[model samples]
Target: MKGLLVLLICMLTATSVFAGKADTVKLRQHLIAITGTSQPRNHQHTAALDEVATYIKKEFEKLQGQVQEQVYTVAGKEYRNIILSMGPADAPRLIVGAHYDVCGDQPGADDNASGVAGLLELARLLHNHRLPFRIDLVAYTLEEPPYFRTEHMGSYVHARSLKEQQAEVKGMISLEMIGNFKDEKGTQRYPLAPMKLFYGSRGNYIAVVQRFGNGSFGRSFLRNYKNNANIPVKSLRAPAFVTGVDFSDHLNYWHFGFDALMITDTSFYRNSNYHQPTDTIYTLDFRRMARVVDAVYTSILNL
Candidate 1:
């Protein structure tokens, strides 16, 4: 645990060249606070997830955007998905989201705290940028098991509401686990042999995962990102049923027939600490994490 503390402190020490000094400060503070586990249970003092949403909403509001809360009840308890939007309200929308809940009591730094950090950092960068469509930075809840893949998932509720309203969604971008990275040979693992052959065995790359037959957004975004970002990027467009393909908040959007993709570090494929108590901020690479956020920013700007 002492070693872990040292490593987590290193996360704060990184001078993020990609995110700029000011944005890096916001990312560090938010990531540290978000990963401080309160160990709340679903039916008990469930303020843990609520706290994450509140912090994210406050940060977004600080950047001069209005925050909205979509409240839904599950098992008689209220859960919220916090949102902030920019650009024309009636235009087609681009949803960027990350779930803030861990699998259990662990800190879950890489499992999702890193992703939320990316989400927050992106929100900061997009504060003044304008696009033809609206962009929403959403902080979702209840993404981990025994709630994962269930309709009660915060993302499911949010996605269903969009479908019900018949909102014209351009695409959804879900940040799953975007921090952890490794450069050593054989450091990365894949669900199948062919994927390893296609995407490579190095775990140092961030990937865009899309279901086959989905819209061309993922590929176009990947192409733009490849041109402007300094980090390595790979893309996977496979059967939706493939293991690890439809694993995050993006899955809910896919289910609603909206094009969606996940940006991630491949989760358990490269991080052994996933879902474990050791999955603290120590294991994350925030500099590279910042690059991932910058890559997404560049991609969206070019799109």
Candidate 2:
């Protein structure tokens, strides 16, 4: 009995170590450094964008993974989307993306810096781990407005190229504004009156949102992530015409008939600092963000 107890303890400790939390401090610092400054529109912070991309590339290369850059010029301004691939590159691929750009004078910590933080952490967690299918981790630019719904959307460019080349993409997951959580009631809001009945008022749960036709993939992804992370998750499927439905970079992939979902905190619905200067790193819930990243890692592996 004593030996059996010791073995169980060891196993539990190993599991805990493997499922350790994402580095909140590192994530916070990354966001603070980028959005803390005035990354103005049309004059976007090119230096900061390059810095974050370099950091991601170095981290992935440290694990002996292959990293590539896809560069495109938008309105005479050059921008590059960083891509990191693990496992067999020729196999069916799952693309995970988050835009690393900010809009206006706001430090877009929750607006999108949080999403980038999650993406970087996800890449770190799955760095050395092998998977059955190829995973392409991307950091896109120009997800914010003025370019959001237009053809200038960075995701639109990337996804369109994939379609043009006939790349076999199995599915895509977009991480957007996923670092904030609140356990208090009356903290969450919805676009439609009926949605309030389906979801709770507390802002503690992560949301899996999709359009009407994409509900099946949304539910399946939500179920898998819920089972893996054991974290609170809220799901909603509605027509894209609804307000705040096409709020993330994922909407671009959906335009191309790809099965995609947005993992978010509902952005402006719950986060008070959505597009303001107050969207700093201090306001984010890093613990939950780490769990979400872990769940994503597991979901991709299973897919």
In terms of lDDT, which candidate is strongest?
A: 1
Q: After superposition, how far is residue 240 of candidate 2 from its true place, in Å?
A: 0.9
| Per-residue C-alpha lDDT of model 1 across residues 1-303, encoded as one tens digit per residue | 999999877776654433343255666787788976476323244787777778888888888566899998888989888999888889998899998888867888887888888888888878876688889889888888888999989899999999999999988999999989999989999998777877888999998889888887777777888896778988888898889999999999988999899999999888999888898777878788888888888788888
lDDT of 2 by residue, 148-251 (tens): 88767778888998889788887789999988899999999998766778797889988888888873556667778878875788777778888977788888
* Candidate 1 ranges with C-alpha deviation above 4 Å: 1-22, 40-45
Model 2 TM-score on a 0 to 1 scale: 0.90
- For each candidate, the alpha-carbon lDDT, in order, equals 0.84, 0.79
Please state the error at residue 83 of candidate 1 in Å.
Answer: 0.3
Q: RMSD of candidate 2 to the true fold? A: 2.8
**What local lDDT score does residue 223 receive in model 1, on the 0 to 100 scale?**
82
